[model samples]
Target chain A: MAAKNGSEAAEEHTSSAEIRSFFDSAPPLKNSLEITDKLKEFLDKNSLSAGDGRANRIVCVTSGGTTVPLEQRCVRYIDNFASGHRGAASTEYFLKAGYVVIFLYRRGTCQPYCRSLPADPFLECFEFIDESHIKVREPHSEAVKMAISDHQNVVEKGQLLKLPFTTIFEYLQMLQMVATSLRGLGPHAMFYLAAAVSDFYVPWKSMAEHKIQSGSGPLDMSLVQVPKMLAVLRKEWAPFAYCISFKLETDKNILLKKADMALSKYKMHVVVANELSTRNEEVVVVTGDEKVSVCRDKTQVGCDVEDPLIKLLVEKHAIHIVDSCS
Target chain B: MAAKNGSEAAEEHTSSAEIRSFFDSAPPLKNSLEITDKLKEFLDKNSLSAGDGRANRIVCVTSGGTTVPLEQRCVRYIDNFASGHRGAASTEYFLKAGYVVIFLYRRGTCQPYCRSLPADPFLECFEFIDESHIKVREPHSEAVKMAISDHQNVVEKGQLLKLPFTTIFEYLQMLQMVATSLRGLGPHAMFYLAAAVSDFYVPWKSMAEHKIQSGSGPLDMSLVQVPKMLAVLRKEWAPFAYCISFKLETDKNILLKKADMALSKYKMHVVVANELSTRNEEVVVVTGDEKVSVCRDKTQVGCDVEDPLIKLLVEKHAIHIVDSCS
Candidate 1:
C-alpha cells in the first residue's frame, strides 16, 4: 500500500497513491479492529438484519476537531478550531429527519441534545430539594427534561450510534471502516463531513519519538499536506453514497471559491460553506449546479440553521436514492 | 513595562524584564479587568475581611491546556496534550484540606468533584422514571448525590472559585491577575501550576489577521519562545507564595534533570516530575533538599496519588507559613 519510491509530489495536489501511502505508513489506532467490529455489528442489527424489506437511510456525522500530532507519542498537536457544536446539533436534526445517525465525534466534545446546557451542566443543573432528594434546578428543568426524553427516545429505537476518536490517524481509520461497511447499503448511505480535520501533519515515520525539547534553540519542522481522501472516498470506498463536505474560512472572499473547488475536485455532491464568525447564523450550500443560502429562523425560539440544512440534504439524498434505483 | 531593546540574549534564559515585555506587547485579554475585579472582591470577602484573627489560606490551582493561535482570527491553533484529570482530582483534595481554591482552568476541562462522571454526565446520568418525572439512574445515584452536595457545600461557603480560559493570552493574563491579587496574603498564598502551557507562540503583532491560507505552498513560520513567567512569578508577582510547578516528560532519563533545572532556574519551592506513561501511577516530588517518589496506594479501592500529594504539599505550606513568621 506504500507509495512508489521518490514520490514527493507537489504540495497542493496529492495523488491517490500518495494518500494510500500516508495511511499505510501511519500506525493503526489501538482500537481500530474493535471499532470496526462494533460498526459491523451495529449495521447488521440496525439495518442489514432487520425483518423489514426496506433499509433505513443512514448518515455518518463526523464532529469536533481532529488533531495532527507532531510526535509519535503526541505531546503536542496542531488542532482546528471546533467545539463540535455544529455536528452535534446537526445529529439531533438528522435523527429527527428519520435518518439512522452514526455520530463519529472527538471524545469530550459537545454531544447531541446536550449543546444547550452550560459547560459544567451536571454541577449547575441539579439542586438538593431536600436532605435526601435532588432535582433539576428550576431554570434548567424544562430543557433538561426535554433533552433526556429526546435522547432516550432515539436510544430506545436504536437509531443513534456513537464512536469517538481523538487524533487524525484514529479519525481517518474509523472513517474508512465506516465507509467500507456502508458500501453494501449503496445509495442509502450519506456522509456529513462536518469535523474540522487538519490540513497538514508530520508524517509518522519522521516524527520525534519523545517530546520535542525546547532547549534546542528554535524549533524547526516541516509538515506534509494531508492526502485529499475525499476523492478516494468517492471513487473507491462508497461510490454511490451522497457526500457533503464543509468549508469554513475567515476570509469571505475565498469561501465560495474553495467550496466550488472541493465540489469539483473531490466529486463531492455538495459543499457547505460557512464563515468562521457567522457560521451559527447562516451558510451557503454549494452543489455542482447551484448555491443555496440557509439561515436560521429568527421568529422561532430555538430554530437552528441545521433544521433547513439537514432538510435540504435529506431531500437531495432521497432524490439520489430514487435515481440510483431506477 | 516593555523590555529594553536587544533583549534576546539567550534562547532558554528569559529575564524578568523580557517576560513583562511579552505581556505588555501582547493583546490583553478581553475580560482581564473584570476578572481581576472579581478576584479582588472574592478574596476580600473570603480572606481579608473575615472577623476572626486568622485569614484563610488560599491556593490557586491551574488546570488543562493552553492554546497558541496560528492566526489572529484563530481558525486553527497548536494545542498541548492535557485532559486536566490530575488538576481536577487535586482540587478536590485541596478543598478537603481546608484551603480556599481558585480553579483557573481551560474552558470545558474536567471539574473537581465531577472527575469520575461520564463525558456527557448529565445526559448519561439521568433518565425518565415515568411520563412526567426524570430521575438519576440507580447506578450513578449515590455518586451524583455526593458530587452535588460536595460542590454546593464549597460554593455556598465561598471556598471555591472557577475561572476558565482557552488561549495562551487569556491564561497568562489571568494568572498574572491572580498572582498579583494574592500578593497581600504573603505566605498564606500557594500556587499549583498544573496547566500545560504552550512553549512557543506567534506574537499577536505578527500573526495573520485572518485564517491562514492553505493555498500558499508549505506553511513556513517561526514561533518565538514563550517568555519564562515562573521566574517573574517567584521574584515579583507573589514572592512569598509557596509555588509548585509540574515537569512532564516522555523520556525517563531526562525527567528529574529537567525538574531540577526548573526548580533552580525559576526558584520554585517544589517541582513535581513524572513521565508521560507512568504519571498516573507514580510521580517524583523534587525539592531543593530531597527527591521523593510518591505512588498510588494499591490497597485502597479508590485511593488516588493526588490524595497523598496534596497532603504533603499542605504540610509543606504550613511549615513555610510558620517559617516566614519566625
Candidate 2:
C-alpha cells in the first residue's frame, strides 16, 4: 500500500509545488488566507477556541459618536472626537490575548488599516452656492458687490463636497436598530463605549410638504434629548453585556467624580478618566472595585491606543495573550 | 563690532556643526520635520488661503444607520439592512477629494477612516449586552444576534471593522446638526442621502423618568410616519444647498412614482434609485430632469459607489472635482 503508485507521489509533488508558487507570488487573496491561517494557527496552538471554554472572554466595543435628529427639516449632529485609534489598538491586544471582541462602531469611524472601499458608485462633488445678484447697501454697496463678485468667481471655479440628509428623525431611527441588535447577544460580554453619542435631537413642527419660499415664518427648529439611549442600554441591555462608561472632563475632579458616579449608577466594571482640555498623554483606568488603578503612557498624537488598553485588560484578566505586538 | 561678531559667528559654527552631525547620524526628528513640511506644502498648494482652492471642495458625507428610540422597550424599533457602507465610503471619498468634508453621521454606524481617540480621556468601547445576561428571543433574534455577535467578536479581537448603532433616531439627529452647519454656508454645497433613513418613527406614550421593567402591564410601541426631510430642506435651506435623496424600491412604478414625488416635494436636483434587493456593485442613477442616465461598472465588493456618484455631480454642475482616485 505504501508503494502503491508513482502517480500518487507525482500528484502530491505537483500540489506542493503549486502551493509554494502561490505563496511566493503573494496575491491579495492568498495574503488574506495566509493571515487567516496564521491567526487560526495561533488560536489553535494555544487554547483560544470557544470549544475550549475560553470563548467566555468576550468584550464588546462601541466606538465613534451618535447623531441627534430634531426634525424632518433640521437635525443636530456632532462628530465625537473618537478616532477609534484607542479602541482598535486596544482590541488588537484583546484578541491577541485570546478574548472574543464585539465592536459596536459608529458609521464613519475607523476601519481596518487595509480595508478598501468598493469601486462602482461613481461619486460626485459639487458646490451649490448661487450668487447671481447682491443686495446693494448705501455706503458699503460697492465694496460688498466687489467682494461678492470675487467670491462668485471662487465658487464658480471650485467644487464643494455634497453630503445629503433628509431629516434628523430618520437618522436616529437607524441607531436604535443597531443598538437593539447589539442588545441581543446575551451577557458574558463587555461593552467599551468609546463612541461619541450625541446629546440632542431636533424636532420639526409643521414642516412643509414643498420647499417653503426662502423667507417664510421665523422657521424655528426645535431640539430634544436623544431619547436617553445610555439609560435604555443600562436598563434593558446591561444584563447581557458588561458595561464600561467613560467620562471625558476638562476638570480633574469632575472627571473622577463622574467616573465614580457612573460606576455607581451604571454598575460599570471599569471607568477610564482623562482630561479633555489638556494635551498630555496620560490616562487613569478605574475599575468598579476602586482598588484597581492602572496608568498607561501617553500614546503619540497619531498613534493607535487600542493596543495598550487591550494589554491592560488582558493583564488584569490573566488571559492567554498573543505575542504579535504589531 | 566686527571682531566681536566674527568671534560669535565662530562659536555658532561649532554648535551648528554639532546639530548638523546629529541630524545626519540620527534623523528621526529631522525626518519628522521633513514630513511636516511636506504636509504643509501640500496644504498650502490646495488651500484657499494658499491661492489654490483645490482642497476646499466640501463633501457632506453621512454615516451610520438611523435609530428610533422609545421611552420604554419596544416590540419593534424600526430598522433595515443598512451596514452604513454607503455613508462611510462617501466620507472617505470626500476626504480624498481634498475637500473640507463635514461628515454628518448617525450613532452606531461605522466610523470615518481617520479619527483619533485619546488615551487621556479614557475612551472605552462598551456594550450593554454583558450586564445581567438577558437572553434574546424574537423573529429577528437570530439575525440580530448574528450581527451583534459578529461585530462583537471583531471588536473584541481588536479588528478594525466595527459597526456602531442601535436605532434610527440617533442617526437622524447626527444628520440634522451637520445639515444646519452646511446650510449656514449657503448654496455651493452638496448633500448625499445614501444612508437608509427610516420613513417611520416610534411614537411614545409618555416621557416618565422611571425604569421600564420587563412584564410591565402589556407594553406597546407605536409607529408613525417620519415627516419628510427633503421637503423641509428645499423650503428652509434651498438656494443654500442642493439636495439628493435615495429611493430604494422593489417595483419600478413605486420607484418612479416616489422619485417624482420626492422631486416635486423636495425640489431635489437628483434622485438615486436602486432596487430594494440590489446589493454589491449594481445601482441606478436617476436624475430629476432626465438630463442624463448613466450606468457604471459592476461595483466591487467592499469598495464604494461614491466615486461615480461624485463624478456625476461634478460633471452636471460643471465644477472642479477633487478626489483620491488612486
Candidate 3:
C-alpha cells in the first residue's frame, strides 16, 4: 500500500509477502463470485470427465491494457495504449489450432474476430433493409459474416470464455484466480500473458476519496511499484503450466536484454521480445537456449505472424506435455 | 516546453504568450490539413451566402477524455475514466434543436446514435443469414435500425462533422482550429466544452525518447501545468461566441465555488456545474446572476436530464444572439 511509498518500493517485501499484501489491500472485486462461478462452469465443461482420448488442451490469453486508479471512486487513472490486436489475433490462431481459449481482456478493446471491421462506423457497414432486417454492405459483408459465424460457433460450443478486467488490482487477482483454477490441467494449460499491465499503482487504502483538485500546483504522488505477480503465477499458482510472457520496448538495443532478465527472473518458459516500431512485422523469441526471430510472410497479402507464432507455441506445449509425463 | 516546470507554472507568460509557447512546442498534427479541409466544406455548406434569412448556428462539442503521454514515444499516459455519455447525448439534443454539431471526441468513445447498443459482442447482435444478408437480433432490432438510419442521414447530409483526437496536443490544436474557423458565426457559435483534459503534463521537449525503465527507484517526474487556454479562447479566439463550459466534481461542497471562479475568470456565458455521482440526475447552471437546479423527471422511466438542459441552453443562446446584435 501507499504506507510504503515508492522510496520504499522494492527494498522489502519478499515475493510472497508482497503478493499477499498487494491482494490484502486491494478493493475486493465487485463480482468475484460471479467470475469464479463462470470460471467453474467453463472448467467443468472441459473437465476430464468427458473421457476424450486426451484431455483437451486449454490456454488462457490475457489481452489489452490495465489501469491504475488514483482515487477510491476512480475519477482518474494511469493507462497505456494497447489496441489488443496481437492478443486478439493470437486468440483466433490458438482457437484454430484446437485450443480452448480463455480470453481475459480489457473491456471495450479489440475482440478476437472483429479486428477486420473498420474501427468507426459500426452502423454504417450495414444496409437497413427494414426495421427487422439489415444487409451487410459490400467489402464488409464477407468480413461480418465470417466474424459473426466464427465468434458464435466458438462461444456457443464453450471453446472461448471471455473475462474482462480494467484496473491493475482486478487484473492480478483474476490472473491468480485463473492460474489456480487451471492448475489441474498440468502441462496442458498454457498462460499467454500479453496484457499491458501497470507496473506501479496507488494502493486502494491511500487513494483520494474525491477527485484531485487542479490548480493546486505540481501534483506529487507517491506511486508504489506493483508486486511482480509473474513470479507468483509461475512458482506457486500454475507451476506445471507452459508460461510465455512478453516484453515490448521502443529501444531495440535494450529489448532482448530485458526479455532475458524477465525470462530468468520469472522463470518464464519463453519471452517474446518486440520493439515498438516493428512489432507486427517481426519478433524474437528468447528462451533458455536460444533466440529465434519470427517474422510474417511479408510477400503475402494480409498474412499475420501470429499464425506461425501460435503454431510454434502449440508444438512447444506438446513437447512440454511429453517432458512432464516422462 | 519543460523549460519552466510546475514550480514556475504560473509565474510568467501572459495568456496569449502561454498559448503561443504551448502551440509552438507541440508536435505538429499528422492530419491537420485534412481536418481543416473537412471543416471548411462543412462551413461552406452552411454559409450565409445561401441567402438564408438568418445565419446557421453551429456548435463545437468536445467530448470524452484527453491523455497526457509520459514519454515522447508514449508507452504510458495519464488518463481519466469517461464514458462520454453526456457529450454524446447532448450532441443529439443540439442537432434536434436545429444546430449543426462538430463532435470533437476521443477515438473509440461512445457515439451519439450508437449509445443503446451493447458495449461488447458487436458481432453477436446480428444473425448471419448468408454471405450478403444479416438480421438484427430481437430486442436490438429497433435500436439498430434507428441508429443506422439517423446516423447515416446526418453524416451524409453533412450536418454532423466528427473529428477524433487522443492526446492533449491534438485536442487543444483541434479546439483552436475549430474555434478560429467558426469565428465568422459570431454569437451564432457555441462552444460546449466537456472533455476531461489533463491539468498537468510532461512537457514534450523533456520527455524521454523511450519508455521509462522501471526497477529504477521511485520514478520522480516534474509535470508542468498545462497552459489554460480557456482565457485565450474567450479574450481572443472567439470573443463574441456564446461559450458554455462544464465543471465536474466529486465533492458537491466545492463544485459551485469552482464553477463561479471559472465563469468569472474565463468570462463564460454559462458554467454547467455537475457533481460526479448525481450528474445524470441533476446539475446546477451557474452564471453571473444565479444558480438554477435542473433535474430530470423521476416519474418517467427512460427520461434524461439532457433534454431539459439543452432546451434551457438554447433559449439562453437565443437571448445572447439578440443582445449581441445591439
Candidate 4:
C-alpha cells in the first residue's frame, strides 16, 4: 500500500530524477538503502580507504578576526570588520556532512552553532520603561536583570575575568599567536579566511607621542602597510590547510578577475565572490577549475541564498556525486 | 561714605586682628593668582613630558569585549559584557587635559556615544558594527526597538562610521596594524591597553566539517591560550611609546601587585589599577615609581567621588600644580 503521507514524503525527497530512474531500473530502493547502511557500518568498523593510503577527506575553517588595543596601559583599541554570519552558516553545513572541520576564529564571535555555551553570567534582563518601553524592574525585566546581576553579584563574591587591551598592535599579536597555534593542526585543514582584516594601520612612531589637540589644525600622519596576513597562511602557517579566500567586489567583472587572481596567487581551493551592494544576495563560488554562479531572486523577502550555497557544497562533496572532493 | 554692603561686612568683622591679617594675606594671594595664570599658559603650550621626551600626561582607554555571534553565517553576534562606558570616560578625561588623542576603535561600540559626541572626525566620533548590519533591520523585538531603530537609522544614513571585525584573529590583526601606525608618532604617545580581549580561542583542528548529529555527546574542543599581547607590545611594536597597563583586580591588595607586575614587565610609565567591586568609581593610578590609591568610603551614602582618580592624574601631570608629581 502507498504511504498515507505520500505527498509529504515526496516533498522531503532531494534526489534528482536521473538518480531515481537509475535506482528504479537497477536494484530496489530498499535493497540499495540496506547495502548503504551495511557499507557505512563496515567502513566505520574497518576504516576503509578509497584506493589510497593517504586520508583525503579533511576540511579546515577559520572564523573571526583579530583585535587591537590603542596603548600599552590596556585602554583604547581598534579592529577591522567581520560578524561571522557567513562563517557560522558554512560551519553548520560542513558539520552536517560528516566532514571533520577545523574552525579557527576570534574569541568573541559567535560560538559554534551547537557547542556547549557558558551560561551568560550577566543575563540581567531589563523591564519595559513603559508599555512600549521595557524598564529594568520586576517579573518582566527579571531575566535580563538576573543575567547582569548574576555577572555582577558573582564578581561581588570575588570571581570575574577582566581582559583588556589598548591598541591594534596587541590585537594582531594575539591573532598571530593563535594562527601559529592553528598551524600545528597540519594539512587537510580548510582555512576559510573570512575575517575582515584592516588594510591600513596607525604607524606607531608618528602617532605614539603626538598630542591630539581639541580644536584640530591640519592633522596628518603617514600610514604603512601591515604585512599581508593571508600570505602567512599560504607560506608559514597552516601550509597544508586548504586555503579559501573571499573577494568582495563592487563590479562583477572585477570580482571574477580578482577571484581568479586569488586562486592562482594563494592556491585557494574555492573563492567566494560577493557583490558589495545594498542587501545584495547573489554570489559566485569560484573553484580552482570551474566557477559556480548562483543568482537568487532576492525580490522575495527572507529568501536567503545561503541555503542553496550549502546544498551546492554538499552535493559537490557527497560520496554519491562523481566530483566529490573527499 | 563706604558702600552700604560695607556695613554688613563691618558687622561680620569682629576682630581687629582679622582685618589686619586679611590685608597682610591679600598681597600674597594676588601674587599666587599671577603665578597660577603664568603656569596655566606655559602648560597649555607644552604638554607634560616623560623624562625621555614621551607624553607623561596620557591615559589609555578601551571599550568592547568578546562578542558571540548568534547566527551560523558569521553575522548576528553577541557579546559577553561590553557597553564601552569606561573607554568613553577615559577619552573625556584625557581631552580635558589638553592632550592629543589618537583613537583606534571599532564602530558598534561607539554608536550611542557618537550621537552625544560634539562633532569632529580626526579623533572624535567613531561607530563600529558589522558592515552588513549597517543597513539591515535587526531582528526587532519590542524591548530595545527604540535603541535598535535609532542605531540603525544613524548607521544607514552614514551618520556613523563602522570598522568591522568578525573574528578575534582579524581584530587582533587590525590592532597590530594600528599600533604600528601609532608607534611612528614618537615617544609622546602613551598606550592604554584596556579593551577586554578574549583569553581562550578555538583551535583549528576541532571544528566539525559537517554539522554534528542532533543527539548529544561529549562535545568538546581544545581552546588554546592567545599569546601575551602586552608582552608583544613591550617586545616588537611601539617600544618607545609610553606604556600604561591596566590592572583590574577583584581584590584591593592584588591590584597594586598586578599593576606593579605590568609596570615592570612592560617597562610602562604608569599603570591604572582598579577594583571591579564598584562600577561608579574605584580605581588607582600606579606609576612604576609610586602608587596613588583613591580610597572611597563605599559604605557612606551620598559620598560621590567626582573622578577622584582623574583628579589625581590632573594634579600629578597638570603643569599648574607646582609640586604635584614631587
Candidate 5:
C-alpha cells in the first residue's frame, strides 16, 4: 500500500480527503490489531462502557514531539520542541485522580513517574559493592524506590496503558484508532492533546526513496501543510469526547488570540495557551465561556504546573459527563 | 555573542573560515571552561598525560544526533536520524578494553551500560509487592543488576566522564574543547565520530529571532553548508589522534565509496561503512590499507556487532600509537 513513485508529481496542496486517502493507502502498522484489542480490554475491564454504572473516566494523553520525515526511508526529519514531560507528568496526575490513562507517547521520551530521576540515572544512581554486586546509592535510593513502586502500582492495576510512536504517520494512525475505539464511551472519554505535532509534511508519494545526499549544491523542496485533523476528530471520530488542545507561542501578544481561534475553528472544548518562556510556571486555560489562569504554587519546591491543571480539567470533564447524560 | 540580526543578508555558502567565525561570533557556552577543567582532572587522575608512563588510552566518543535550529529561541529543528545505540554500546566495549572514555552525547539519547534496559525500564522492569514495596521483576532483575553494577564500576573509577549537548553549536564547541585538550596527549588520543550531524544549518546570524509563524505562507529557507570539522580536527586540533568516522547509507552502491572518500578526504585512520538495512548485522571497516567486514554472530541473541567493531578499532589505534612513537 506504500506510495509507488518518489516525487513523480509535485502536489501543491493537501485536502482533508487527500489526507484521509493517504492514510488509507499507507500500510497499517504491524501491531494495530494488538493495540486495539488491548485498548478494548482495558476499557471493558475498567467498566468504562456507556451506562456501565461505573464512575471511572478514561483519557488518552499524547506526549513528546512528532517528526515529519523528509524521505520515505527517513534519515532526516523536522521535529517540534518537546521532551514529553508535560504529557508524562499529566498522566501521573490523571492516574492519581482515579482515571485510566492511555499514554500515547513518542518512543524514548520521558515516562511518567520517572521524571525525577537523575539526568544519567542508571550511571549516577548506583553504587558498586563489588564487581558482581550493586545497590542504589543512599542519596538516590529513596527517590528511585518511590518512582518504581508508584509506577508498578499503576501498571499492575491496569490503570495505565502505553503506546509508543516515532514518525508522523504512526502517531496520527494510532491516534485515530484510539479515538475511534473510545467513541462508544461518549462523554466518559477525554483527550489531552499535549504532543507538539508538526504543521507541515512531505507527502509520501513525493518523498525521496533513499537517504538525501548532500553533494547537491542546494536543496529546493516544497512542503505541503499537514491537513488539520482536529475538525474530523471532533465532528466524526468521537463527537462526545471532551477534547483539550494546546497552543504554544513564543510571543505573548498572539498566544490567547491563537488559542481562541483554535477553540472556535476546531470546536475544542478547551485550549490551553502558554508562552515558551513561562510555560513551566503558568498557563491560561481558554474555553468559550471562561479563561482560567493556572499557576504552579510557589511555596512548594519542585512542584509541577500540571498538578493544578489536571485538577481543573477533571472537574470540567465531570461536568461534561453529567450534562451529556441529562 | 548572540548574532545581531536575523537573516538580513543571505549568505549562499559556508567555508572552514566562515564556520570558525560562526563559532567565534556565537555566544560561548556558560559551562565550557568548567567542563574543560573537569576533563583535565579526569585525565590527570587517570595518569594519561604524556611521559606519565601509563598505557591508558583516552577516547572522546561523540554520540546521538545534533539539532539544527531554525530560530534563535528554537521551537523547531532539523534532526539527523540517530538513537545513540551504536555509540552507547561501543562505549561499554571501549571501557571493557581498559580505555578511559569521555562520552559527549545528545541530552536524551541512549547511554553506556543502559542500552539493555527496556524502552520504559522504570515501568516494565519493576513489580509492586505492596503500595510501599517494589522490586525488579524476576525476568529483568539479573540484567538490570548487572548493568547497574558494571556502569557504577567504571564511573567510580573515573574512567567515564559524560557531557551532554542538544544543539549543533554546543556540540561543535564542546568537541573543539575536548579535542584541543587531548592535543597534549598526541598519539594517545582517539576520536570515535559516530554522531549523526546535520550537513546543512541555518547560521545563527540568519536564524529567526522568534518562532517561525505559520501564517507567513510557505516558509522559504536557505541553509548554508555545515563546515567539515573533520578536516579542521586532523590538521589543526589534534593531528596525531587516531580517528574513526562512520558512513551510513541506504544504498549499498554508494556506501563503500562514501566511506573511502571520508577516509581520504579527512585523512582518518579508519571509516566504518554500513547500509541502514544491515547495519546491525554487518559493517565494513575501511582503512587505507584494507577493508575488513565485521558481522555479528547470528547464533548469539544478545551479542551486538559493536563488540567486534570496537575490538578492531582498538587494535588499529594501538598500532597507530606505536607507529607514531617510533
Candidate 6:
C-alpha cells in the first residue's frame, strides 16, 4: 500500500490515540478471561506447525450488526442494520475451501448453515403427530436435514468456533482478542470483517445510569465517534494477516468510492462493495488494482452470489499467502 | 379509575394532538390494508356476540420492544429493552383461561408455547444421525415435543392470532387497526400492553434519507417525544375495553409510583409494576383499590411469577365482564 498523505497520516495518529483512550475508558468485558481462553484453545487446536504441508488456514469471520448502548444498564440502544447473511454464507464457503473458521457474530442474527431453516420461532417447521411425538413438518424436513448435517460436520471436526457479542464494546474487544490470538499465523490468518459496527456511541462513563425519562419535552443527545479500529488492526493488532472489509451503501454512486476509501485507509487487501437493494444478487470486490463484480447465477435454482464470491476471494487469498511466503 | 390532575389533563390533551399529527405526518403503513383484513377476520371469528355467555373473551396481548428509525431508509434505530417474555408467557395463560388472543408482538421476540423450545438458530437442538435423517438432540427432545404439541393445539383451534410489528410507526398503526376491529367486543375485549415502546423518535419528514455519515465530529440529533397512544386507545379506539399496562423501572422506590401515574393518566384497569432486576421473580399489580404483590413459587421447580399473575388477571377480567353487564 502507498504511504498515507500528510492529512491522512495525521488522522491515523489521532485515531490511534483515540482507540487507546476508548478502550481504557470502556467497561471491562464481562467474560474477558473466558473469551481469551477460548481463543487460545481454538488457535492451539487449529494452528499447525510451520513445516506441516497441510496446515489449516485460519479466517476470523465477523457477522451481524453491533449495538451502541444509550444507557449504562442498557434499557435503550442504537443498532446498525445487518442480518449477517454475507458472513454466514461466506463462512460455509470458507469451510468448504478447507479454512478453520472463527465465527464472531451478534447474538440474534443469522447463523451459518441454518439459513434455510425457518427464521425463529420456527414453530411453523415442526408438527406434533401424537401426544408425545414431534417431527419436522414434511415440507421443511429436507431443508432441516441438510442444515443439521452441514453444521454437524464442521462442529464435529472442530473446524468452527462461534463467539457471540451484542454491544459495540464487546464486538470490538472480542475482535481485537481474536486478531491478537491469530497474529502468529501471519499471512495464513484472514480477517473477513462483515459486521456493521456502530459509527457513534455514548461513552460508558457518560451514559445514563437509568432509563431516560420520557416526560421531559424533546430529547437531545450527543454521540461521540466510535474510534476507528481498522487502522490499528492492520498496523498493530495483526499486522501480517490478510484483511477483507465490506462497504454497504444505499446509494449506488457512492458505494465504489467508499469501498476505495476503505481499501486505502484500512490498508485492506479487498473491500467488498454492495448496494443495499442489490446486495443479495451481486457485490463488487474492490482491490487496489481491480474491481470485480460477482453475481449469483440467475438461471440456477438455488445458487447465490456467496458461492462465487467466496471462490474468487479464496483465489485472491492464495496469492496473498504465496506473496507473503516469498 | 380516577380523573387526571390539572397538569396531567393538559399533558393528555397535548398528547392527543401530538398523536394526531404524528399519525398524519408519519409514512403510511406498507401493509395497512392486509393488517386491517387480518384483524377483521380474527375478530369476526372470535367475537361470538352478546347473548352467548360462553363467548370467548378477546384479549390483545402486545409484547416486545419497538424501534424508532434514525433514517428514512433506516441504517440505524433506537431500540427499547424487552425480550417479549412477559407477553409470550401471558398469552399462554390467557389461552388457558379461554381468552381468544390477538398477540401483537415485535417480530423475532419470544413466542407463546415457544418458551420451552431452544432459541433460534436452535441448530444446537438438532442432530443428524445419517445424511438424510435429522432429529431433535436427545437432551432437547422432550422440550421440542412439548413446544410442538402445545403450539399445534393453539394453531389447530385458532384461539390465537398473531400480528407482528418492528418500528414504532408499524406498531401504533397496527395497534389502532386491532383496537378498531375489537371495538364491537366492548366489555369482552382486553388490551395487555407489555411492549416497551420508544419514548422519543425522529420525525419521518425530517429523518435523513441515507445513512448518517460519520467523521464530522460528534453527532447531534433532536428527537421529539413519541406521542402517547394509550389515551387514544382507551378513549377513542376501544372505549369500553378493559386495559392492563406495564410499568418497569430500574429503581424499586419509583416502580409503584410510575405504575400509579400510568393507571390514572391512561385510565387503565390495571398496571403491572415491575423492577428491572426482580421482574421475573415478582411484580406488583396496581389497581384502583389494590397494590397486590405476586411472587413466583420458589418451592416448585418450574413455576413462574407469570402463572400467578395471569390467574389473578383472569379473575379480575371475569369481574369486569360481570360488572359491565350489570
TM-score of each: 0.94, 0.37, 0.95, 0.38, 0.91, 0.94
Local distance difference test values of all predictions, in order: 0.84, 0.42, 0.84, 0.43, 0.82, 0.83
lDDT of 1 by residue, A34-90 (tens): 887888777876855332223488999999999988877888898877999999999
Q: How close is candidate 2 to the true structure, as a TM-score?
A: 0.37
Q: What digit string (tens of lDDT, one per residue) describes model 5 on residues B25-133?
A: 5657889888988988998888877632235788999999999887788888989789899999999999888889999999878888788788766667666566444
Candidates ranked, most accurate by lDDT first: 1, 3, 6, 5, 4, 2
lDDT tens digits, residue span B1-326, model 3: 11122343445333666677789878999999999999999988867223221348888999999998888888889899888888889999999998889999998888887778887536657776665556678887767877888887788878899999999999999999998888877888899998888887777887777887767345555666788788788877888889999999999899999999999887899999999999999999998999999999899886789889999998898889889887
DockQ of each: 0.36, 0.02, 0.41, 0.02, 0.29, 0.39
Residue-by-residue lDDT tens digits, candidate 4, B1-326: 00011122222212445324323322122233443343334334444322222243333344556532212223222232344555545554555564444343443454332323322111111111232111112333331444434434443433222233334454455455545644544454556555656543432223232222111111122233334466566566666555655666444655577678768765666678766555446666788567766755578863333246555655544432232223
Per-residue CA lDDT of model 6 for B39-85, tens digit only, reads 76666666544423435788899999999998888888989669999
Task: Label model 6 with its docking quality class.
Answer: acceptable
Better of 1 and 6 by DockQ: 6
Q: What is the TM-score of chain A alone in each candidate?
A: 0.92, 0.52, 0.94, 0.54, 0.92, 0.93
- Give the Cα error of residue A254 in candidate 2, in Å: 30
In angstroms, the error of model 3 at A137 is 2.0
Evaluation by DockQ, superior candidate among 4 and 6: 6
| Chain B TM-score by candidate, in order shown | 0.93, 0.57, 0.93, 0.54, 0.92, 0.93
Candidate 3 deviant stretches above 4 angstroms: A1-14, A48-55, B1-14, B48-55
Cα error, residue B87 of model 2, in Å, equals 1.7
**CAPRI docking class of candidate 3:** acceptable
**lDDT per residue as tens, model 6, A1-326:** 00011222224333666888899878889999999888777777775434222256888999999998888877889996699988999999899898889999999888888777776626877667885555678778777777778888897888999999999999999999999888877888889999999988888888878777776466777787788789889999999888999898888988899999889988999999999889999999999999999999999897889999998988888888889888
Displacement of residue B252 (Cα, Å) in model 1 is 1.1
